[model samples]
Target: MGLAGALATPAHGDTKAPAVVNDARLEAAYVIMGDGFATVRIVTGAAGCPALTIDAKAQPMIVRAPHASLPLRPTASTIANSKPSVFPITVCEASLPPGAKRASVDGRPLPMPRPVIRRIVVIGDTGCRLKASENAYQACNDPEAYPFAIVAAHAAAWHPDLVIHVGDYLYRENPCAPGHAGCAGSPWGYGWDSWKADFFTPGAALLAAAPWTVTRGNHESCERAGQGWWRLLDPRAMQPRHDCNDAADDVTGNYSAPYRVSLGQGAQVVVMDLSHAGKKNIAADDPRYDEFVSTHDALARYARNATFTFATDHYPILGVTIPDGEPDKPPKAGNKAFQSTFGQVDKGLVPAGVDVLLAGHVHLWEHVDYSGNTPSQFIAGFSGTQEDAVPLPSRLPVDTSPLPGVTIRQFDAWTDGFGYMTMERTGARSWKVTVRHADGSLLRRCRIRGNHTYCEPIFG
Candidate 1:
C-alpha cells in the first residue's frame, strides 16, 4: 500500500473489554492500543500465539503471522557480527475486548487499562548505551550508572493507570570492548538478547503495570534497532513492520499513519511515527519533505474530533540540544525536518487544538510554555539511557527559539540525572504532572490547562 493507504487504519476505539488469559512460558503479554482495536501481544519460546479465554469462552490469539526477521548474512563473523542474530522468539498478537479487567500470562496476572484512567507514566530513551560509532559505553551492569530497571520499578510502584514510552528502546548497537568495565558482558547487538537486556528486562515492571502506548524513536530507524523494534513493540499490524526490515520501498517502512487512542470522554492520544525525521534540515525539494507534510496533515486531521488531545511523536517538534562535545555552546532547537515540513503544513506546526505535545528524543525532562499560541511541549527522554550532554541552563537565554516563530513564555528543563514523569488527571481538561529523578524524588510539578502548562519546582 502507498504511505497514505497504509496510514488509513484507525488507532483505537473498540467497545469490547479485555479479559483474563492463561499461558506459561510467555515472556510478556499485555494489551496494547493499536489501529482500531485493543490487542493482546505475547512473546514466547513456543511456536505460536497462545489461546486466551475471554468471558468464559476460549478464543484463538493472533493468527500466526510470518516473523519479521530478515534473511541473515551467513557469511558474517560468528561472534560480534554486524548482523542481528535470530532468537527463538515467537511474537504473536490478537485483538481483544477493551473492557476486560483481568489478564494473566503464565499464571502471572497481567495488567489492563483502568475503566477510567487517572494517572499515566511517560518515559523514553530507555536503553544502555554500548555504541562503538560514538565511542560511548555505559556501565550496563551498574545500577547507579544505568538505572532503567530501578526507574521502571519505581514508576510501576507509582501505580500508574497507563504508560507511554516515547521511544529509543534499544541502543546496544555495538559490542562492548573486551577491557571496557562499563559495558562488560552486555549483550550488544540488534538481536533479542540486546532488546531484552536494554528494554524488556529493565522495563518489565512498568510493562506489566498498565497498557502501553509506544512511540517510535530514531534509534529504531531502519538502519539501527528497527528490526527488533518491529518484531517486538510496534503497535501496528505485522505488514508495514515486516517491510521495515528492508529499504525495498520508499520511506513507508519505518513511517506510519497517525492513529487515535481514545482516553474516553472524547479525549484521545494521537500516536505519530516520527522515527524517520532526521536532525538535518530537509530541503523543500526533498521527497521526504512532502511525505512529512502528509504525515503532519494526517496528525492534525486525527485530533480534530477529540474533545481533548495529547500527541506523541518521539522526535521533539520543539526541543533544546547542544553540540556533542560543545556543552558550553548555545542550546539549539531540534528536529529541523519537522520545522521544514510542519512549517509549510501549518504555520503553527501542529493544529491549534492539540493540547499537549509529548515527546522524548532529547534525553531529559523539559516543558516549554508558549507566550502566544501553541501546545505546550514536554520532553521526557531522561528515563534510563545516558542523559545527553551536560545539564541545560536553569534558564535559557531570553531570545531562545525552540521552533520558528514560537516564543517561550516560561519553561522548566532538567537533566541532573535519569528521571521520568507522571501525569495525573485533575479535571476533564487539566492534569497534574510530576517530574521525578531515577530515585523517584519529585523535581517539578505542573498543571495543564488547554494548550498551557505552568511548572514550578517542588521545593525552592
Candidate 2:
C-alpha cells in the first residue's frame, strides 16, 4: 500500500550491506544485478513465506515459497494486488553509486535512497519460416517451422530487462521461389494459428521470459491490412492513434500512446508508431502524405526530455544504399532526402532527448548513424526471414555515397543471415548497441549519445 523499497550493494557480492525495507514482515529487499538478468529471493519466519508474490517490472519475477507450501495457493488479496508493493519502488538496471548505503528495515545496511540496475537488450526482425536450398526460398513444415524459439532462447541466455521489436512481425510479401509450393496462399493472409504456429507458440520461452514492446511494419499492412498486427503485436493499441501529417509538430496521437518506460535514473524509452505513413502502395501525392508529415511532427515533440529516446517504426527513414536512379522509393520522401527533413524532424522533434531510431521492413540487417542530423539511426531489420533464401540481391538497394555519421552493418550468414541486436545502457545518457550475428559473434557496435556524434562502424 506504500512505496515498495529496495536494498542494493554498491559492488557485486557485497553481503555486509543490510536490507532496506520498511515492513520486514510484509516487504522484502532485493539487490538486482545491473549486468545480466537479475533474480530476487524472498524468505520469511516459521517456514519460507508461501503467500508472497514477488514480481519485477522489467525482468520477469517469480515468488518461491521454499517449496514447502505444496500447492502454493494465492488468495483474493494476491488477485487484487497489482502495483509494485509500495507507492513508488525504485528500479535499478545501470550502475551502483559509490559508497551508496541505506538503513535496512531491521537496522541492516542498504542502499539509502533507491535500488536500480543497468543492462537492457534490444533486438528484432526474427520469426522467419523458410529453408534455403539451391539459393531459393521454400517453406519448411516441420515440428519447429519458425526460428523464433532459438532466437528467444539465446536472448534468455543474456537476460535483458526490455526487448524492443521494431517491425515486420508478419511477412506479407514472402515471395516464394517460382516452383516452391510450400507457402501457397494469397501473398499475405494470416490466421491466428498461422501467427502462433509461427512465432508465439514456438517462441514461447523467449516471449514469456521477458517484456516485449513491438511496432507495426509494412508487412502487417500487407496481409489482411494490419489485421494480425492489431490483434497480436500492438500492445498499446487502446491508447490513441496520432495524425501522421501533424506528427512533426505534435507529440501524442490517437494510435500513439505516449508512455514513459523507465530504466532508472531518469532513463526513458519513447515508443511511437509509423503505421500512419499511408498504405503500402499509396501515391506520393495521396492525402496519406499528410499522415507521414503529422507523425514526424509528433515524434519531435515527444523527444523533448527523454534521455535516450529510441523511436520505433515499421519502415526505415535512412537506408543503406543510395538510390542509383530509381528516384521512386520511400527514402525519397523520408530522411534520405537531402533537405535534412529527417534532420529537421530529429532536431526539432527529439532535439536533445532522442538518441536512437530503431526500425525494420527491408528484411535486411542495416545500422545507420545520422549523427549529422540529431539522434542517430539504427535500421536493424533482417530479423531472419524466409525471403532471405531467394536471391533478390538486385532488389536490395545500394548506397554508393554514404552519409557522414552513418554506419552500415549487415549479416548474410546462416539461416538467411538471421540474428538480433543487444542494446546495453553503459552510462546514464549513453548506450552501446552491438549487432550480433546468429552465431553470437559481434558484427559491429556503436556508441550513441544524447547530444553528441553517433560513433559507429562503417560496414562495406
Candidate No. with top TM-score:
1
Model 1: lDDT to the true structure: 0.75
**Candidate 1: deviation at residue 255, Å?**
0.7
TM-score of each: 0.89, 0.56
Residue 374 Cα positional deviation in candidate 1, in Å, after optimal superposition: 1.2
Q: Candidate 2 lDDT, tens digit per residue, 1-460?
A: 1111122322233334232333344323333222112223222222222121222112222222111111111111222211111111121111223334322223322222222325555555554443222243435332233345566677656776656677665442233456655554423224333454455544555554444556665445422224344333443211222211122322333234333345566665555555444323444565444455555665566666545566667555544432333535422213333123334334333345566666665555654444344445566665545434222232234442134443333312122455667877777777776666554566666665664433344342
lDDT of 1 by residue, 1-460 (tens): 5322332332233233233334466776776777555666778766665656565556555422333456442111233357745666777665566577666544456677666678899999999987775677889999999999999999999999889889899878777878889788888667778888998888888888888888999888766677667767776655733545555643666677778777776778888887878777889888778778887787778777777889999888877667567877887755678777888778777787788999988888888888576888899999888866567777777778855667887777887788889999878788999999888888998999888999999852
How many residue pairs clash per model? 12, 53
- The best candidate by lDDT is 1
Candidate 1 deviant stretches above 4 angstroms: 1-24, 63-69, 72-81, 240-242, 323-325, 403-405
lDDT values of the candidates? 0.75, 0.43
